[model samples]
Target: MSSVRSFVNLIRPSIFVHCEPIEDPCGPSATMADLN
Candidate 1:
């Protein structure tokens, strides 16, 4: 179960990283071009 959680988090970060601009309205930092 712990391994599964770690795997989920690993994949999760990548998903969040790729979200970039689309998630911007939720936070000001989201508009930062450097995030892309």
Candidate 2:
């Protein structure tokens, strides 16, 4: 979702440097926590 993308974008320049570009591919519960 766009909301998830926005969250990832917010962190992309910092802690997310080594993260994948999967876009919440891991599902809602975990992704939601990570997004927050």
Candidate 3:
């Protein structure tokens, strides 16, 4: 499960970049907080 999470984390940055124009709470920063 951790490996999957890590894999998702790797790809999330690109998605985050594309989604950055929106004021969404599911950004990388929020994800990191959730991960911790």
Measured by lDDT, the strongest candidate is 2
Error of 2 at 24 (Å): 14
Q: Which regions in candidate 1 have their CA more than 4 angstroms from the true location? A: 13-36
lDDT of 1 by residue, 1-36 (tens): 555556767888554232223444567655556754
Model 2, residue 10: displacement in angstroms? 0.3
Error of 1 at 25 (Å): 45
Candidate 1's displacement at residue 12, Å, is 0.6
Off by over 4 Å in 2: 13-36
| Superposition TM-score, candidate 3 onto the true structure | 0.33
Measured against the true structure, the TM-scores of the candidates, in listed sequence, are: 0.33, 0.33, 0.33
RMSD to truth, every model: 8.4, 8.0, 11.7
Tens digits of per-residue lDDT for model 2, 1-36: 556667877977454433445556665566566665
lDDT of 3 by residue, 1-36 (tens): 555556767988454222224365675666456655
- TM-score, prediction 2: 0.33
Q: What is the C-alpha lDDT of each candidate?
A: 0.54, 0.59, 0.54
